[model samples]
Every structure is written in C-alpha cells, then in structure tokens.
Target: RRGDDGTALDRLAGAITYAARLIAGATRRTGLREVYSPSSSTRGLRKLDSWVERALLEKDESLSTATAVAAEAIRQDLPPLFAEVVGRVLLRIGRLPRDMPDAGDVAYVPRAGHHMPLPPWLPPSRILGGFYVLRPIGTGGGGSVFVARRAEERHEETAETFALKVPAYNGAAAHTLSEEEFLRLFREEAGALLTLPAHKNLAGFVTFDAGAKPKPILVMELVQGPTLERLLDKRAMSMPLALSILDGLAAGLEAMHAAGIGHLDVKPSNVILRYPDDVGAPARGSTPSPTPVLVDFGLAGRKVRPGCGSPYYGAPEVWDTAAFGDRTDPRATDVYAFSCLAYEMLTGKTLFSGDALPVLIAAHLTHQDGPESLQWLRRHRQAQGLAEILSLGLRRDPRKRLTLSEVRISLAELGRKRLASLSWPLRN
Candidate 1:
C-alpha cells in the first residue's frame, strides 16, 4: 500500500510538471517570455513563490508531504521559476490527505478590526483556457478584471501582457437577468471589443478567447496608469493637463463614432491616463504628457438600450429607457457622459452625487444648469470659451449635442488660446 501511494504521488507530480510546461508555453506564445525566468522579479512571480513556500511549510504534514516532495523534485528537475509555478499548480489541485483534520472545524480568528479572510473555495486557481490569471485588479456588476499573461511561448522578443475581463457569474445570480442572459451579455461585450479596430486613444484589444472553458476572457493591453477617476481623487487637475486629456479622449470617441461604435459609458472611471514614456521611449528630460485612453466598452454598441450606463452620467433620454427604448442614440449618450467627465476634469467634482440611482437619474433628467464646479472655471475670463464648448456637448437635447468631431475642434481652439495666454505672459 505504501509503495502504491508513492507511485500515485510520482504520477501526480509528473502531471503537474506537464501542466506547468503547457502554461509556460502558452504564456510564451502570448509574449510572456520572462514568465518562467527565475531572475525575473515581477509581482506575479513573487506571489507564486510565496504561495509555494507556504504550501510546502504547511503545519499539516500529511497534507503538505505530497506537494512538498513533488515541489522539491520539480525544483531539481526543472528550471527554478518553472519549478515554482508547477509547485503552485500542484498545490492548487492537490487534495488534502485523508488523515488531515477537517477544514470545517478549524476556526479562523480575525485580527482586531481587520475583516476575516475570504473562504478558500472563493479562489479557484485552475487555468482558465490558456490564460493564467495573475491577480484581480477590479470587479464590477458586469465582470471582474484580472492581470493575466498568455501562457504559450511564441517567437517574440517581448511578451505581451494583458488585462483579462471575465464575467462575474457568482454575483450575477442575484441580478434581475437569468444566468444565461448575463453570460450572453458578457459574450456580446467580448465580441464588440474583438470587432473594433486599433486606435491610439482607445484601449488596445489583443484577443478574445470565447472558447475558454468555464467563462470567456477578453484580453486587452495592460495600461500602466491610474484611471481619471483615481487621479481626480488625489487632486484637481490643471487646465492645460485637463484639456490635453480631453483632446485625446475626444479623438478616441471620434474614431469610435466613425466606426459606428458608440461607447455608452464614457465617464472618468472608464478613462485611463497613460504617460507618453509608458507606451514608448521618450526624449531626454522630456516633460510627461499624459494621454487619455477610453476603455470599458462593456456598455458600448451602435444602438444599445438606454439604461445600461451609470445613472449619474446618463443622458436625459437614457433615464427613461422604457419610453425611449432603442430610439436612444448611443453616440448621444456617449457625448453626454463625455461632457460630465469633462466637467469633472475641469473641476474635481462629480456632476451628480447620491446614494440612490433613482435620485441620481432624476437629477440628470431635471437639472438644466451646468455643474456648480464649472462655475469657478467659467469665472476665469480666459476659460469662458472653454466652458461654452463643454456646454454644447452637455446639451439636454441629443439633437443639440455636439458631435465628437465638433467637440474635438472646439477643444483644439480652446487649447491654442490657453497656450497663447501662457506664452503671452512670458513674451511680455
């Protein structure tokens, strides 16, 4: 019996080693060449190392022995980083020994005010198709975003990194829609992103793996800066910086509109601010120019239902989806939301704020005057024209709203005026 157990363990270890190789190869093909490199000091590698070490040194000897032995053999047999990854995979899949104490009986004590740790069942580390999920970056009603790298090795110099968006089935169960409907919506989002063409100001779509087991994953370029919402949380932005970001975002929206794609959800939270140096090489002592990239196209479409986006950013027609239905122009909705974002950027305050969605919607529908935050901006006589430009986009009547191209042109003129003002003082 003991000999049989040893043989079984060896076979499991071999399977785990093979799985590791497959994962490494897949990531490599996706442009993650350094995934299994021992010398690489990436956060993902560090987390894997820590998890493996903890599993190996677990107090339950019976439970840890198989995994530890397998991990040690892999460490000796494979490359250092590869061994660590394999060890983690094995630990994730390996069953607890029969002799171990029941996990249910083990009570966990929270440390002071800190919340109790999430249940173990919550995190299943199984490989989802070919993408190895590194860590979750954000979660929303639609889905969760993970920092994932391709596991297959490809003949490329730099491995491509991506943000994987997966549907949140767990939370979707309580939603009004059925599980099937929710999943279909998720798939639709992936399809929309895949069909869109590459644009500099738009988040770059890499690939969509709908065939992925369990759930489909949408892969997009991993932008390395904070969202505009987060930036606003830190501090208010300068006029020049705000206008530059607005220009980039307007251009992105224009491209999407031209492609017959309407990003219904165009708020500060969905805009990422990436510095020029982050995307490519920069000149020496070059001033950092942040480019705003529009993202989160989950609510985007040429003709989408009106009630899909955040209430605070929704256009007047969007508030009553039941009445407007499909007649709602998604482009107009985007313009309205873009105006709200622009207002927030100009003055670090949201146009509407409330706990209830209905109240927020009502405010958006009934409130005719511009945001109070913009009043200060308008007070700056030099920036009055900028205020008027934004007003045109925020017009309650969708027909009166400025198209993305018009907004872009208006912003360009405003930018020139602001630049001239700055240089005029210097010339004097």
Candidate 2:
C-alpha cells in the first residue's frame, strides 16, 4: 500500500510538472497582461495529499475503502481553502472571484439558498434591505460580498454598478477585528480603492455602504470577467490575450502605486478581464479598449507587513520577517508581487511550484533566486525595453526594484510603441 501511495504521488507530481510547463509556455506566448494564474496554486493538491496521508495514518477502514480518497477529501476540503485563497488573491489583484463551474469540481462560493445569517451584525432583512440587495458573490476572512443594486439610487452623473461587502458570522472574528475594526478596515479598503480613480484596468469604489451595520460595506464598480487564475486551469490563454491582460494589469498597478496603494496580493485570481460595456466604454472610434481590471483592496494598505501576505506572491523581502513596518515603503511590496504575477503570466505557472506548504515554506524561510523570467531577461541582455523594465521590477532587493512610478512610465512608453504601430498607415 505504501509503495502504491508513493507511485501515486510520483504520478501526480509528473502530471503537475507537465501542466506547469504547458502553462509556462502558453503564458509567454500569450503575453498575459494580468498576473493571475490558477495554475500558480498547489492548494488543491495539498488538500488532497494531506487528506490521503491523514486517512492512511488513521487506519480508518471506512475512509480507506473510499475510491480515490484524495479526490473526495479534496472536494470536501478544497472549497474553504479555495474561498480563502481566492479572497486574499482577489483583494490583491483588485477583482472578485467569479462562479466558475468549469475551473474545478469543487464550488467554493456557497449558493444563495445556502446563505446563512452571519452574527449580531447581519440578518437576512438587513442584507436584503441594504442600499441594493443582490445575492452574495464571494466570502473571505474579512466578510461576504454581494452583487448589490442601489435601492434609493443616486449617482453623481457617474452612476455605476456596485458590490457590497459585509462581515461574516465567525465567532472568533470578534476578537481579531471588532465591529469598529471591521468598519475601519472597510474605510481603509474604500479609501485605497477610491484613490485609484477610473481606469480600464482598475475597479473603483463609488462609496462606503455605512447605512446601518457597524461593520460597513463598500460600494464599488462591478467588474465583469472571470479571474485570470480560473482561465489558466481550463486552458492556456492565446499570446495576444495574455499580452492584453498583462498590459491592463500593469497599468492598473501603475495607478494604484501612484495613489499610494500597494496591492499586496498580485496573483492570477486578483486580475480580471473587464468588458467594454462594464467600464462604460463608448463603442466608437479610437477609444481605449476595455481591459483587465485589478480588483480587491481588502489586504491593501499603506504599509504592507512582511510575511503578512500570500506566500506564493510575497516579495523576497518577506523571507526576512522583520522587514516591514511603518517605515517600510509599500511600493517595494507591490514590485515583488508585480514581478511574481508577471512571471506567472509569462510562464502560466506560479513563481514557486510545489506542494503549497512546501512552496510557502521555501518562500518564507529560504533564500532563492527570484522568478526564472528575471534570469531569462538577464541572459538575453538585449531583449527589449519592456523586458528590461520587467527585470528591474523583478529584482530581489526591494531597494533595487523599479518604483511604481517608474513601472508606469516604462509601460506607457511600450503603449506608445504599440499605438504607433497601430496608427501607421500602409506604405504603398
């Protein structure tokens, strides 16, 4: 049985490696704009492996008889982890997780009927009565997100669809972030999101839903698209699609950096492709095309803590746990995640691929060369101006990375080149 288990693990590892390679190749070819990769996460596999090992050790005859116990265990355990990971990554990338049936067998977000009233704060009526009551779209450590429609709707000649987020009913949460803390966090998130004004690549907050609840919700623009992470699983994106995605994400990050907001979790799930109509883009001539919008500012703040963000995308500086504080510059954190997501977009794989626990452990505890793309760029010194810029943003040393402003300037230059090419008339 042990031998069989070992064989299974080996097979699983090989399959993962193959999948990783395919994603990597696809990303480079696709030129992904957003830095979200579903393939970047090994949590699914980790859940499965942990379950199998635990069951095998427990010597539980009933669980042992179960067919492909790993799959069953993963199905059961993955939903929660999926929700948690998706929430964190989305907050970083600046988007919400979509209901993707095809991405995986497990459904992370609960259905409408399954929605239970959260604690002293959220009752069904309050939820249904808020500014605009839509069904819950997502849930995370912070709270639940609903696709709300304004009740007594008012827009400053700039009406937009918005999402409302409220606190969850977890008993333990009371101690962590009190009702006041929750409201404060909501404002913090709102302030950060609002700072990043309108852009094709960013989802902006319209207002703070502080009507009744102590833990206020945020009313923000509704982004329409599946996350980049979900897209990577079913298939690799076309190079053109990838480039389009990355360009938009980079631009969004540029805006965020300029606004003093550093997206701490720049992963595949956080970045999304938004439709033209979603961003209210006019269907006329020479208008900027709708692009990926970076969403979720739940974890974004002025000073990101070292090792306090997602392990997969955390900067190399995080390995030195003491590097973050009031004095720490947020742009450095953004650069690290920006580089990781950029690499994943280019490679269709996570910067670090292994069991989730191991990969995270390595990212947190060990010193290793940054993403291979950084090395690749170094090897080809004369690649391109854009390539060089990406390399600079990807440097391991926080001080050495390009500031958010620098990244924006470089990307704008690239955009100019692209526009120039598009505008050039045929030379007869």
Candidate 2 matches the true fold with a TM-score of 0.58
| TM-score winner | 1
Number of the top lDDT candidate = 1
Off by over 4 Å in 2: 1-121, 128-132, 151-161, 167-189, 209-214, 277-290, 306-308, 316-321, 368-391, 408-428
lDDT (Cα atoms) of all candidates against the true structure:
0.62, 0.54
Q: Which stretches of candidate 1 lie over 4 Å from their true place?
A: 1-125, 153-158, 169-178, 185-189, 279-286, 369-380, 418-428
lDDT of 2 by residue, 1-428 (tens): 11211223333433443444555566678996322232323445444433444444454333232224333333343344543543343233112122324647745433331242334445555443356554555566546776666665533334445666664435333544566665665466556666666776777766665445555666667666656774555333443455566677877777777788777767776776555654432222324444777776655667554344566777755445354334566678788677667556644666555666557756534543454435553453223454567667766667778886677567566545642233211111
